[model samples]
Each structure stands twice: as structure tokens, then as C-alpha cells.
Target: MANIKSAKKRIKVTLVRTERNKAIRSKVKTAIKKVESAVAASDKQLAQANLKNAVVEITKAASKGVYHKNNASRKVARLSKAVDSINA
Candidate 1:
């Protein structure tokens, strides 16, 4: 219950931002899961493909402030390591 008109607008903006952030986070999780599953299946090609997608999504999230830059870097590094291990 916002008494002021500005407060009401702020509430609406917050709601929209919340939904957008949730969608971004969901996409990041799904991308990570896809990479993990590909790794678990021991499919290097598939893993690499998924890793690429995951990295893109993660970096995008980071750029948008959904994730910290360091956090996104770590995720991409870990995924890359897993894919590398598959080849090694």
C-alpha cells in the first residue's frame, strides 16, 4: 500500500525488475545444469557446447548485475575445467 504516487510507481518498477532478475537467474541455473549434465554423461562435444552456452548466459547475467563479475568468472572457469578434464 503506497500512499504516494511516486511510491506506487517505485513499487511497480521493483516488481518488474524482480521478475526480470528471476528470469535471468533461472536461465543461469538452467545453463549450468545443462553443462553439468553433459559432463556427467561424459560427452565432450556436448559438454563443450553447453559450456559455451553457459558461459554466455553467466557473463550476460554478470554484466547485467545479476551476478558479480568474479562470481561469473569462477563459474565459467569451473565449467571450462570440467570440460577440459573430459578431454584429458
Candidate 2:
């Protein structure tokens, strides 16, 4: 319902950005889940591997503005802690 041309363009851009953000968010969630599942299975090596991947994905998301820097840091910290606990 955007009558102005600029408004129409903005709406289109918004939709595209929304989809992109959703995909990034989904990827982040999947990565986090993988780490959690590996930890739950009590496989330290698998958990460590998944933790590395999850950290990468989270950092990328934060850099891309999908997540706040502190939020991403917190997530990585918690995941790392879980993996470390397995080793202890």
C-alpha cells in the first residue's frame, strides 16, 4: 500500500532484508543446536568441532548485524563453557 515510488522501493528492500535476516538467524540456531546436541551425546571431540563451527557462524552473524556483538560473545562463551565442562 505504498503509493510513493520511493516507499515502494523501500518496502521491497525491507522484504528482502527480512528474508536474509531470517536465514542468518536460522543458521545461527542450527549451529547452536549442533553444539548442544554434541555436548548432550557426551562426545568431546564432536562437541569441540561443533563449537568451533557455531562460534564462526555466530561471529559472522554479529558482524553482519544479525546479532549484537555482546549477544554473540555471550553465546560463544556459554558454548565454550559447555564444551570445556566435558573435558573437566
Candidate 3:
């Protein structure tokens, strides 16, 4: 437990930020999984749709600092590739 008031406030802030980050990451993971499932099922249109959603979620996460920009780009690239494979 934090003894000082400022330290207690910092602890509360940290908890809030942690929870927000966790939620954002969870959303990104779910988006990725949706795209992957669509790809696995060979549903081209669905994959494309889910790819857009995944990209949005990933970019949002990156912007919020939950993920690095390059990491987000890589995730988008991999998902795009998987979706493209469904077309080919």
C-alpha cells in the first residue's frame, strides 16, 4: 500500500492504465482471430472485412501505445497476407 497521497494516486492511475491496455490488447487479439478464422474457412469476403477491422483495432492500439507502430504494421501485414492467400 502507498503511504503518501501522491503515491496512492499514482497506484490508482497505474491500475486504470493497466486495465485499459489489457482491454485494447484483448480487442486486437479478437480482431486478429476473427480474420484468421475467416482465412481458415476460405471466406474471402469475410476475411477482407475482418482484415479492415483488425487493422483498425491494431492501429488504435498502436496509437494508444499499447503496441509499437512497427509491431502494429507487422500484424496488419501478416493478416493481410493470410487474407490474400484465401484469394489465391
Clashes of each: 0, 0, 0
Candidate 2 weakest lDDT stretch, 10 residues: 79-88
Q: Residues 1-88, candidate 3: write the lDDT tens digits.
A: 8799999999999999999999999999999999999999999999999999999999999999999999999999999989988858
Off by over 4 Å in 1: none
Pairing residues by index, what is the TM-score of model 2?
Answer: 0.97
* Candidate-wise lDDT, in order: 0.95, 0.95, 0.96
How much is 79 displaced in model 2, in angstroms? 0.4
Question: How far is 52's C-alpha from truth in model 1 (Å)?
Answer: 0.7
67 Cα displacement, candidate 3 (Å):
0.3
Per-model TM against the reference: 0.95, 0.97, 0.96
lDDT of 1 by residue, 6-70 (tens): 99999999999999999999999999999999999999999999998999999999999999999
How do the residues 32-86 of candidate 2 rate in per-residue lDDT, one tens digit apiece? 9999999998999999999999999999999999999999999999999999999
Instruction: Please give me the total number of clashing residue pairs in predicted model 2.
Output: 0
**What's the best-to-worst order under TM-score?**
2, 3, 1
